[model samples]
Target: MIDFKVLSDYAATFTHSENDLLRQMEEKAAEIYIPIMQPSAMAFLQQLIRWRSARKILELGTAIGYSSIRMALAAGNDTTIVSVERDEAMIEEATQNIEALNLQERIQIVAGDATDDLSEVASAAPYDLILIDAAKVQYEHLFEKCSGLLADQGIIVTDNVFFHGLVCDIDAVQKKQLHRLVKKVDAFNHFLSEREDFDTIFLTVGDGMAVSTKRSCAEGER
Candidate 1:
């Protein structure tokens, strides 16, 4: 197999350069050790939004609203995003970032645990696209909640499915906590692959991404 890291780096050279605001956000996220989406993966995500013309997007995790902002910008001016984050600090920063871009109307940050009841999120049912980039251990739980909120033929994209390639070699992980997290991520991959209601594909995009499209009832029945 080709060296993916090298290939990804080379491919990123062709993607559009980050603007001043995005560049600043990238720098700040790096300085603070905030885990934002890789540029390559983010490019793929933006393309998905453009391809689907996604108008309503729900992001399970909003670290600093980086991905949410990117999606809104690509999905068109009419697009709206509802992002959930439990961390108070992160939510504050993300809100500031969204406001800085004058995207307050396009992106709304909901303060709460994604795994818990989000009545506000539920009220805005049937999102066209849902991005899951939350805690690895709770991926399945998040998926369950997102499934019901997804519109017919909607897509759910899960990030960090590979867990830094550790899922491929769990035995190599010495830390028990990390090992358990990797195992859970691996199990979620299996669970998602076997889902009856959606057709899923795993991509080698940055840190690995899993894109699943809801199958129509007729297709599921068949």
Candidate 2:
């Protein structure tokens, strides 16, 4: 069996080292124990943006704006990113980080519950790409909401679907609350797998990422 840790470490060696500002944000995120996309997964996301030429992007979580900034950079100057965050502290920090890079015009931070009415988000409909990395329990809800706003052939990328490997062994999760959360994550994965409208592929990169794209009518018929 392949050692995932070793594989991840090896993959890290191939990824570009983050620039100084991103490095500082990463350090701060680590020191404060904030959840951000793993470097390998982040690199994969950037690659997707470049390959797809995704100009309009939507992110469910704006944790310090790390991933948003990364996506903006990868998508080039033509990209516009709308990132939503409920936490005031996270929004403030993310705004500062985005401004530090003078990316205010490129990235917009929306403040509110992502699972709630996303009328503002819908206004920018038909996004070229959508990224979900918010609450684990609300993954399904978020997915359902974001699907409506995705472009015809656009992709939806979800992070932390594995929930630190806990979803792989729900019974082994000692804490009751954590076990419940793990079960929810596991259910969401199954839900994604069973969806008929989209073709979802699971990758074991960075906890786990589920990349889903809308299926064409002929593909759906198959």
Candidate 3:
């Protein structure tokens, strides 16, 4: 196919404006150039969890804990979040943020490469919801690793699947700053679409988001 992206109801995707906390922190992250999920996307995530009745949530990136915190608060008392971040500094800030929210018991932050040794993080696996927003090239690896960790009815939601619209035609974006990202997202999308274990849907949102659910998993897998 010429276009890697299938047309989606752009208007209906996690559609909502920024809330107060989202607006304020988004400004702060911008001041420091600390990337976080857009408010609209977070808003959608909130809807997603509520609709999916998410009980356990796993996040691949914890840039400033903005989205993590948002997800936790929106999930309420029953939900627990385990977010992974590679950067030490980011982890420190996220730790403090989690504590400040009095969510130390509800949210856990792990420090280390998310893909390097998931064996440790795997303890939190079989998650009902998994949100990935870290390194672009590792999307496929994360998906595979997280698959066995997902519950039967779990969903894996990934952000930045478009990579600034480059995923559609890497030849044109190969020379751009986002060339590698575009190529990787395309690779991940291609890999997922062919898999029978999961049902995947790619939506064009902030950068882009792909929501996949574990369908009939392969033999010897969950």
Best by TM-score: 1
Whichever of 2 and 3 has more TM-score, that candidate is: 2
lDDT of 3 by residue, 109-178 (tens): 8888878766557887779999989888888998888887889868999988777677667888646657
Regions of candidate 1 where Cα sits further than 4 Å from its true position? 1-3
Model 2: CA > 4 A from native: 1-3
- Superposed by TM-score, candidate 1 places the C-alpha of residue 29 at a distance from the truth, in angstroms, of 1.9
Mind sharing the TM-score for model 1?
Answer: 0.96
| Residue range 106-146, candidate 2, lDDT tens digits | 99999999998767788988899999999999999999999
Q: How many Å off is the CA of 194 in candidate 3?
A: 1.0
| Candidate ranking (TM-score, best to worst) | 1, 2, 3
Clashes of each: 0, 0, 1
lDDT of model 2, residue 63: 90
Q: Which of candidates 2 and 3 is the stronger one according to lDDT?
A: 2
For model 3, the stretches where C-alpha displacement exceeds 4 angstroms are: 1-21, 174-177, 216-222
Q: List the residue pairs that clash in candidate 1.
A: none
